[model samples]
Target: MFISPPFIFEIDLYREVLLFGDGGQSGKVGLWRVWVRFYFCSSGVSIFYVGREFWDERVQVCWEGGGTPLERGILRLASLFYALGLEARKETYRLGLKEASRLPAPVVSVGNITLGGTGKTPMVAWLAEGFRDRGLKVAIVSRGYGRKDEGRTLVVSRGRGPLVSPRQGGDEPLMLAKKLSGVMVVVAARRVEGARLAVEELGAELVLLDDGFQHWALNRDLDLVLVSGEEGLGNGRLFPAGPLREPLRALKRAHFLVVTKRENPSLRRLLASEAPQAEIFEAPMEGEKLWSPLGGELLPLGKLKGAKVGAFAGIADPCSFFALLEGYGAEVVEKVTFPDHHFYRRGDLEVLRGLIPRVDLVVTTEKDWVRLEGLDLGFSPWVLKVVIRPSPRLLDRVLERLGMEV
Candidate 1:
């Protein structure tokens, strides 16, 4: 009896199989051996696929006290390298080996120490709007994550509306450009160049840095560090093993610590202990309204009750969006998530098309909607308009720190 090598391509991770044969015949035993080998090989490949797809989510699970021992071991090994690199970078700045460039106008930064979303974009928009309302010509400088041409400074908007597409300017910057009228938005890899252009070329009196906490290239007058109230510091470890981008001590450099989403007393107390010098504030990311981009009509959030929704988002911490929908009494029948800052493809829209019949309507975040614009999704999605409502005292403190009258 001769057994040929098996050609296996597809591996289903969720299913397991076992094969056996009668020991009486040689042909039957040979085939059984082949099947056994194939089964083991396919199972190995399936495990690899699962790891590749949910790598980030798995690490997050470990950070929040829920991962396998094998996963924890791998992440713990990788995190050592991450820690070494981070410390080296911090030492360079601390020893004055690398000096940050200064912009002409006052610069304020909104960033977080965690690896995922901490409501930084909404806070940036809030500060930009507040300053614009205060009679200051405002400009926003961003690193332009996921942009095509990040080597050079591009003016996303010059106070009116977006001048470039999301592909060229990045999704968040383009979203800010659309939401903020009479505010300039600029994107560059080197934020100093963008800030300089905003100050000299755009005639901006003040500059806001979007996701700029770790951006040590440009000196800022005030550092606003945001933390997610829902997921606070996840195991208090750095990078692969955990969610933190920097160590706990880095919070000491922050001028203000803002906890976003919901209230967390424990997180606030922990932050106060870690950064006693920094002022702590709470700014919940609340849904202001829902509006359709195609129809250009707004609907109150109360309208979400009794609605059947198919929600999809491509943002960090997309579960928060799903939870928000559930909190509003919306039945989220289908929940879809893509990678953070994902560019939607036609196939992705097909998934939504499949859900249309089962759901009353589709819902998505404003950030996702910016990227989804112009893509034919079979139907228009109602975008949730989220705003960060910081206390009035927080604004007053920010103004006082910037040496401006409130």
Candidate 2:
């Protein structure tokens, strides 16, 4: 019997039959022999056995790209322990086994379920402005993540202005301080103590807790959980394995949920099923205008409409930033992305400096701008300031919950 090229052959040992050719020209060639030799004239051939199920499964896991089998197994195990610990801690508080410290002033918390950015800081700033517009003295209490000073509570802003630098206040806290002029921004590891300080020393009428969803220690009047529209509950697993800081069931604890960037129907549907009691709002993360970091002059968004731009962002979602620039009609010629909450060193600046001269302007997020205080990137990088626009109904609901007139 003669077999053609570009074909697949299979043998059934017990059945004593030879299978040849693929679906293209499939037919049996000959009877099975003890030591059969395959002859193929085609350039390439893929011969896969139907058996070896266990090996196939292992290969599939490897293709998924977590890490080596041992590493992935260890990470999954760690994620399991983390989930268990979180549940236990939440139960202790829920059953009154642990007490949460309440501040004299009403508290509002803005946070996310994931480790990456979900526009939490911008939402917090928007809320602060809303409260300030209503003549309320707002104080923002943050964990001051990535700050050099540890343990000690520092006042990033004292109503009049910022008293500390970004290195001392963390990038997010410092950005909040700069954005909100009258709002007092306080940084502490223990937000409960920070809230107390805000009320006692800062004379805060209300406190906005930055990244406070999982804190569990500070009592809050309202909890607003922000979810990213682009990356919704990535992989739907807990930390080490996925992006979730807590289980999906934790959404039930939030008074309000804001879907940032845009309306995510899938996420909305998931929240509706998981947290039926919670109200959901869609908030668009709008880029307002480009500003100079040196003098803080607002440049028209039109300035970049037809300009050749080089973009760099040390944000969790740098692709989103790039997309935003393109949406504004800016031609993004080059882009550089860094890890979320990445601290930029002098060496990093040198790398960016090489890419700056090729474009007309350099654009970065306001958060990234805070980290480049002293560094000279050979050119001025325009900072893109963003504002979160939540529904007016959501603001009214927040005010009502705070015992303030809408």
Candidate 3:
């Protein structure tokens, strides 16, 4: 083995930000980040290395508290690591650009620069379903991120597959497979190979690349980018410095823009400036209360007038969950936020377990529940799950751009 550049050290950093409150402060924890960023600029260096895999966690740590005092000191050494990350990203982008240059087959990517959960899954579903609804054969291509399969081309999932594992194709794509009725979901590391596979093997007319905003190698037809209006590009800095994968300048290539979680009117200018003339649209993540978590036993959220509930989630956007719960009439007594894709620990579960007996129900995101399965869910412990229902009008717009009508 040549070497793997200390990935665990950075992963722990990510775990700290998410599992703890380290990454929660956003703009508030910027005194040191500004200094680090300025230091890099003056030194004529870029702090992108450590690779994207490492940067994912690194970004969370820095985005949270300016990377602690020690991390701030390490910022002087960031460019060496940033260079590593950029090399990998640049290589991937090089391949993407090569693919884009030659292939006549148009690619439209649904992507974001941040780590996860900016509503790309729903957006992809909308694209495929809307296009299929309008009589077009749209297939999806994704990097398969965390999962492994065979060779370059893998049929990770299909709307027709009897049972698809989220663990197999990664949760989002598997979830995409579940929601979409006719689309083909392919997950492979080499997206160029995945795109080619979609066209040749699956008879896909159009390929929608999930999370390809920065995958510059593959050519694109129209780039439709989604960034939450609420979180409007956290801290406005690059990875290990902030939440951005690339600078805001990269958005000049976008054909359309979608600003989700616009429960407030304040984000309009931010959306427009991010993608001027990019046909910006705003929407919110919507859902209904069917049950508490026992599969059935219907209960519409509108009727929960005075239910006392303690909410919890280890999602990229827990505030959205809390707001949704409180919006639907659930009186939120307390909130507990865990890191995105957080594995439940005994210490943390005990905190939640103790609160279960006091609260009417313990609400959480579906992803969190998947991670929390059978953790001795405390006395009559209930979990409120959320389903994202896209706004119909914005859904129509997104579908239209992807060559579909909804």
For every candidate in turn, the CA RMSD to the true structure comes to: 12.9, 17.4, 11.9
In model 1, which runs have C-alpha deviations exceeding 4 angstroms?
1-54
Residue 251 in model 2: lDDT: 91
Q: What is the lDDT of residue 357 in candidate 1?
A: 67
Candidate 3 achieves a global lDDT of 0.60
Candidate 3 to truth, TM: 0.70
Q: How well does each candidate superpose onto the true structure, as a TM-score? A: 0.85, 0.80, 0.70
Report the candidate with higher TM-score, 2 versus 3: 2
Judged by lDDT relative to the true structure, which candidate is superior, 2 or 3?
A: 2
What is the C-alpha lDDT profile of model 1 across 39-67, one tens digit per residue? 11121122110112324457768887889
> Which lDDT tens digits does candidate 2 get at residues 1-406?
2233543333223212111111011221222223222322222222211222123234335334655878667657877977676676667678998778888789999888876678888888888988898899999998786677645788889876678877888888888887788899998866778889999998999999888887777788999999988888877777656667788998999999888997799998987788888899999887899999887778888888889998989776778899989999999987776544556654455545545556888889989988887776566788998888888788789999777874
lDDT digits (tens) for residues 1-406 of candidate 3: 1222211222223312211001113211121111011011111111111212333455467666656777755653553455355455556446663233435456788887554467776677766786777666778987654343423456765558515455556555665665577888887766777888888788887889887776655677778788886677777666555666666776777877777765545555766676686876654667655455554465667655688887777666777778878877889976766555555554465456545555777667655554555567543334554444555665566557656443
Indicate the residue-level lDDT of 46 in model 1: 20
The alpha-carbon root-mean-square deviation between model 1 and the true structure, to one decimal in Å, is 12.9
lDDT of each: 0.79, 0.75, 0.60
Model 2 misplacement above 4 A: 1-72, 94-97, 295-298
